[model samples]
Target: VGDALKDRFDGASRVMSNSDHETSVQRNDAAPHRIPRKDRYRFQLRPHNPDHKSPGVKDLVYLEPSPGFCEKNPRLGIPGTHGRTCNDTSIGVDGCDLMCCGRGYRTENMLVVERCN
Candidate 1:
């Protein structure tokens, strides 16, 4: 990120380079990512044109779309929460109001029997 931003400014290359310092890549076990090293970061392209009737939702990777994740990927064309099931009592991102994109949710009871100690 620093390298990319620095590249935008004129003569910034003289201020810093690989020879001048050691750069560290942080490891994120919780949210691993493989970011491109330079200006190579570009929007993943679909075909030049997409067929509307196709089942593809345009994300480079398929995820059960929610506003929290989908809205962030505008160019990727993820279908944000139009027909997802949500858990109203969830404290995390799967909460009804968030995951359902405020369209609200329906409930159907299920029997969950667990062994007790």
Candidate 2:
């Protein structure tokens, strides 16, 4: 099964290379306002035993695409960083500027009580 899938992928790569070359040549004479057509391919799986009643690859297909995690979505269980800790001094993604999403942060100071014997 693995070998058959690998062979199919290799063949698809060759076809893609040829189509890419043809598209590049066509782009030279194509209008700036025109959009290029995208290439689409479909694959079907054929089991060794036809009598088997197992589900095919189509069973893994989803009806709708997933909603990404850019903002807070309670329905999707994505708790976007509203009160999450962030670094005010740093400039990375964990920094206050990016993490707060332009909403300014307030600084809070807390005293810790520890007992050590």
Among these predictions, the greatest lDDT belongs to 2
lDDT tens digits by residue: candidate 2, 31-78:
653444542333233332456443344333222345755479999899
Candidate 2 Cα errors over 4 Å, as ranges = 1-70, 74-77
Task: Write model 1 residue lDDT over 18-92, tens digit each, in one string.
Answer: 221123456689997676766333333233224422223322222222345534456666666766677788977
Q: If candidate 1 were superposed on the true structure by all CA atoms, what would the RMSD be?
A: 19.0
Residue 80 accuracy (lDDT) in model 2: 83
Question: In model 1, where do residues sit more than 4 Å from their true spots?
Answer: 1-75, 112-117
- Provide C-alpha RMSD values for all models, in order: 19.0, 18.1
Most TM-score-accurate candidate: 2
Q: Which residue pairs overlap in candidate 1's backbone?
A: none
